[model samples]
Target chain A: MEKTYKVEGMTCGGCVQSVEKAINAVAPAATVKVDLENNHVTVTGIEDDNLVAQAVENAGFDYEGPVF
Target chain B: MEKTYKVEGMTCGGCVQSVEKAINAVAPAATVKVDLENNHVTVTGIEDDNLVAQAVENAGFDYEGPVF
Candidate 1:
């Protein structure tokens, strides 16, 4: 399954990388794509959205819930 | 004096607050303002740019030198 969520506070490439890493750290099997321009992160192969969201928050970014 | 710096890995209000606290921690008299749209942090009343830069990095963000 794939889910797209809004992530806030990312401004640079490093932030994008950090977000991706954070997502992966929580869901090792998931693939993460971060749209720096859109502030959205599309994650695939993850079953738990809350885990991914926690990963984002733990990494110091705002996990603005999920993008329906 | 005021200087605007480019900081990476900031996403959300918490990141902004963390950045501000990090800056003030190093330079107690300085003030910090974060522009989420611009990806810039404008700081005032700080004497050492290097110190400020270090502070940003210490806060776990990528400090891309300065906006000069």
Candidate 2:
């Protein structure tokens, strides 16, 4: 399944890269993409909400769960 | 200055505590309060937007700048 989250605390390209790396580390098969300008992150993989949430938290950004 | 940010990706009290600690570590005099239910973080201290943003980023939560 795929999910898109509204993220906060990201200011630059580095932040986006960090978040993506964190998510992939936890779910290697997941596809993650972050839009820094829009503050959105989309992920596709097995549904593991906790792992996803932790990845965002670990990267130092706040992540609200799937908005839609 | 005091600012309130809307944070995302926080799932539990532990997330809240982790965020608070990270902020304090960077700015010792800053006061940070996280509302897990509301997903809000209020900070009071000298205004340093970058530091605040970095602190939130370091904690692994997405933080949007002062909502109000």
Candidate 3:
């Protein structure tokens, strides 16, 4: 399943890398893309919302949970 | 001079705090505010741009220099 989440604190390319790393840490099979302008992160192959949320939080980002 | 900088990697309130602390560390008298909506940070009371940039970088953030 794919989920779109609202993440906060990302301000650049490095930030995008960090967010990707954080998400991949918990779900190695997941693919993440960040929309910096919109503060949205779309992930594929990750169904556990809590897992993704925890990863984002542990990386010091604001995870506003799954978009829908 | 009051300067506004394009900062990257700040995604949350904690990030804002981190940025503020980093700036204050180098210039204790300076004031820092993170504009998450626009990825901009406006600072006052610090005349040295290099000092502020260094502080932000050392804190693991991307400092894109002053806006104007």
Q: Which candidate should be chosen as best, given TM-score against the real structure?
A: 1
* Candidate 3 residue pairs in clash (backbone atoms < 3 Å): A8-B11, A9-B10, A9-B11, A11-B9
Cα-based lDDT at residue A66, candidate 1: 78
Candidate 1 per-residue C-alpha lDDT over A1-68 given as tens digits, one digit per residue, 9 for 90 to 100: 88899988787766677677667766778999989888999999987889887777656578897788
Candidates sorted by DockQ, best first = 1, 2, 3
lDDT of each: 0.78, 0.75, 0.79
Error of 2 at A14 (Å): 0.1
- Score residue A14 of candidate 2 by CA lDDT: 49
Q: Lowest-scoring 10 consecutive residues by lDDT in candidate 1 chain B? A: B53-62
lDDT of 1 by residue, B1-68 (tens): 99999987777666676577667776789989999777899999987889877766655577886787
- Candidate 3 RMSD computed on C-alpha atoms after optimal superposition onto the true structure: 8.2
Q: TM-scores of the first chain across all predictions? A: 0.94, 0.89, 0.93
Report DockQ per prediction, comma-separated.
0.09, 0.07, 0.07
lDDT of 2 by residue, A14-67 (tens): 466667766876777899888767888989994878888877776556878776
lDDT of 3 by residue, A13-58 (tens): 6667667876786788899999989999999998788887876765
RMSD of each: 7.1, 10.8, 8.2
Instruction: Give the candidate order by descending lDDT.
Output: 3, 1, 2
lDDT of 2 by residue, B1-68 (tens): 78888887666655666677668777879898888788888899948777877767655567677777
Q: What does the lDDT come to for candidate 3?
A: 0.79
